[model samples]
Target: MPELPEAETMARDLNQRVAGFTISQVLLAFEKIVASDLKNFEKTLVGHQITKVARLGKWIKFELDSGGALLAHLKMTGQFIMGDWPGHLSGQWPAHTRAAFLLTDGNSQQTLFYRDIRKFGRLRAFPQDELLSFLSQLGLGPDPLELKPEEFHQLVSIKKARLKQVLLDQSLVAGLGNIYVDESLFAAGLSPYRLATTLTADEASLLLSHIKRVLNESIAHRGSTVENYRGLEGPGSFQDQHLVYGKHGQNCPKCGQALAKARVGGRGTTYCPICQK
Candidate 1:
């Protein structure tokens, strides 16, 4: 899964390649992948110039010069590729391509393809006023990197669930998934099963600090590529630097104790019991 870091990297890559280009045409190879009405979707995007690209939590946002926006959520296996649109009916297009945007920059043309092997991603278009309402409906929480320690602690402490479950709640703190949650807990020496309300203020501060550090480090490495999480550029190297995630039976890097694995919040979780407790 491509989390915050992966989405951020994709946004940056897209900004560099297509930000100033105008959309010459829209292709919906898999119309169902679009969340908006097909007629409005294509019509709104056809002649708009992309002014900027940004990431909100784990979603990619394309800011248009026409005072509108295009948003995409790559739920599990979605990705974007840049190249020519394959010849019509030539079967040169890669499998699972859901949509394509043919772009122009006065002197050159390029096609941006949205591919999702599992077909779980969705795209939507919104005018400026409606875009604000759309984002409000999503109710995504503040980005973890920008949250103050006191605010983060209050958010988590208000939840009665286990630490891992609270961390995975996007409404409480956005952009954390299985891998980073486990890794952050390990870094902060906290148990995944620990009750959120039981953490001391100092512990909360430590956890927040570790979360920010881990996210920054992962972003530097281009995010973890444990599954279908390759950015527009390529797979990330952060998977190689993981501490407890996906290392269930391996010796704990810090404690040399056997790492333990269990199901928490219906997701596989790995942690070093000796080191984290």
Candidate 2:
């Protein structure tokens, strides 16, 4: 699943590539991808020009000139690709693409494509106020990269859940997934199963700083490509730099002890048992 950094990167890329461009046509292969009735969805976007693209948590917001927004949640296996020609990249879809947006110049007919696979992704229309309302309802905590120590301490102190669960909870802190959660925990020398509320102010502060450091460093490497994640091509290079994630039974980068894997919140979690304790 695409987290904050991935979504934010996509938004920044889309903002640069799609903003100020008008929609010439939207081709919907799946209906649920659009929130409104299909007809209304098509009508609402047909003539609208993209004003900006921004990300809130894992969701991508495409602000239109009319003050409405197009929201997309790229759950998994979703790729939004822009090209100088329509359907320029075809083979990536077949079984994966749920929808396509052929963004055009609205004058010369040049087009770009937004494609998604697995049908898990979606594109929806939301008025500005409605978008805000939806975001508020999501209980999404602040972006991990932007979280301050005070805010991080306060959130952690209130939770009695396991540290891993608390970190994975979107409502507590947005953007962290299984990969970064393990990475952050390892970086902070904290065990995944430790009680969240047991963390002291100093420990929480360290965790907070490490989370930002890990995320920023990962983003600098264009995010980890554990699987199908890609900036534009195949897997990213950051996965090579992972300290413990997916390294179960491998040597810990810090302590040389065998890394361990345990199920946390039903997700396979990797950590340096020696260092993270």
Candidate 3:
């Protein structure tokens, strides 16, 4: 799954390329990807100019001048590819390509392709009030990259679940995934199995600082490309330096101990026994 940083990067990129362009065509190859009836969805978007592009959690919001937003959630294998006009690429869906948005500048057209192999990506047209109601359920704690150390400390000190699970929960801290959870724990010398509420206040403070450090570092490197998590334009190279997330049975970077792997919350977790408690 693309975490916060990746989604934020994609939103920023699309904001630059697609905002201010009018939707000349809204094509849906997979019906459920859109919110309303197919005809209604098309009717709502086809003539509206994109006023802005923003992100809420992992969802992409394309605010239109015509009074509704086109929101998309690129679940697991989804991608948004920008196709240049006059040389528009031709290819079949290939068990992917949930939807496509073609925008025009009256002189040129740009095709924003949304491809999701898992078929879980979603596109919705929502009124502002309805959208706000939907967002309210997410309990978005805060952007890890933007949280102050003191605020992060206060939030984590109150949780009682395992440290790893607490970090992964979107309600507690909005953008972290399995990869960053492991990396952050390893950085802070806390075991993935450490009980969240069992930590001392000092430990909690350290954990908070370490979480931001790890996440900000990951974003600076364009996030880890563990699976197919590519940057907006293409795949990134950050996977090359991951300290523990995917380095099972390999030597830990800091202490040279073997990195271990196990199942936590049903996801693969990797860490260093000596370095991470």
Q: Which candidate should be chosen as best, given lDDT against the real structure?
A: 1
- Residue range 1-277, candidate 1, lDDT tens digits: 8888888889999999999999998887788899976679987788999999999888999999989899999999999999886573454556889888999989999999999999999999987887889899999999999999999999999889999999999899989988889999999999999999998889999999999999999999998998778888899999999988999999999979899999988999999878876
Off by over 4 Å in 3: 35-39, 84-95
Q: Candidate 1: where are CA atoms >4 Å away?
A: 86-92
Alpha-carbon lDDT, every model: 0.91, 0.77, 0.77
lDDT of 1 at 128: 82
Evaluation by TM-score, superior candidate among 2 and 3: 2
Model 2 agreement with the true structure over 8-126: per-residue lDDT tens digits: 67777778888888887776666777764566677767788899988887888888887777888878777677555434355244444566666766565545444565667767776
Clashing pairs in 3: none
For all candidates, what are the clash counts?
Answer: 0, 2, 0
Which runs of model 2 end up more than 4 angstroms from their true locations? 35-39, 84-95, 106-110, 233-235
Root-mean-square deviation of every model: 1.4, 2.7, 2.7
Q: What is the lDDT of residue 56 in candidate 2?
A: 80
* Residue 187 of model 3, lDDT score: 81
Q: What's model 1's TM-score?
A: 0.96
Which pairs clash (backbone N, Cα, C closer than 3 Å) in model 2? Answer: 96-117, 97-116
